[model samples]
Target: MLERNALTFNPGRDQDAQPVGSFTDVRELQQELQGHGIQFLAEADEGTTGPASFIVVDPDGNPVIVDQHV
Candidate 1:
């Protein structure tokens, strides 16, 4: 069996999966991380809006997923 874990962020949702009134867009977060020299394995399209996602690798080799479902 193949096994792995990832850290995920849902920008528009809370811990209970309820929508919040406002939250930072995923693209903006990506840009900020990029400015800090973070690289992405898969990237969200900055040109689009609404739900999107991106992936990056942690120093420990774990996948980090930043997904937005708004």
Candidate 2:
């Protein structure tokens, strides 16, 4: 069961990758996000994930995958 969020963010990784997300400006967004103390755990294309995104750790140590298709 899949539902769309108001923010247009995908709840699941594959579901999120299914739709062409509205984010076209990713570089600045990535930089701005990093400036806020969020460090990238792993880059999307760096390993198994083929998308161009980065991972950030939540306060509880959960890996939040921020994916961008290049």
Candidate 3:
């Protein structure tokens, strides 16, 4: 999971059987990826008052998270 208050990536797995990301600021990371021609598997699903996140794929086609806790 993309923890908004996290630092370095502490590798781990999630309930969905996906590895959790260790970074915050989904949009910033997304921009960085876009600069390199990387596309998101899914975009952030924001709400009027709740959490938001986006999804992308790793080299092995595994889903990675970029999240913001607001």
Best by TM-score: 1
Q: TM-score for model 1?
A: 0.91
**Can you rank all candidates by lDDT, best first?**
1, 3, 2
Report the Cα lDDT for candidate 2: 0.52
Better model by TM-score: candidate 1 vs candidate 2:
1
Q: Which residue pairs does candidate 3 place in steric collision?
A: 1-20
- Tell me the TM-score of each prediction against the true structure: 0.91, 0.49, 0.50
Residue pairs with backbone atoms closer than 3 Å in model 2 (clashes) = none
Q: Model 1, 48: alpha-carbon shift in Å?
A: 0.5
State the C-alpha lDDT per candidate: 0.93, 0.52, 0.56
Ranked by TM-score from best down, the candidates are 1, 3, 2
**Candidate 3, residues 1-70: lDDT per residue as tens digits?**
6534322222233545475565345555556778898877776543333355667777765667665564
Candidate RMSDs in Å, in order, are 1.9, 8.2, 10.5
For 1-70, candidate 1 gives per-residue lDDT tens digits of: 6567899889999999999999999999999999999989999999999999999998877899999998
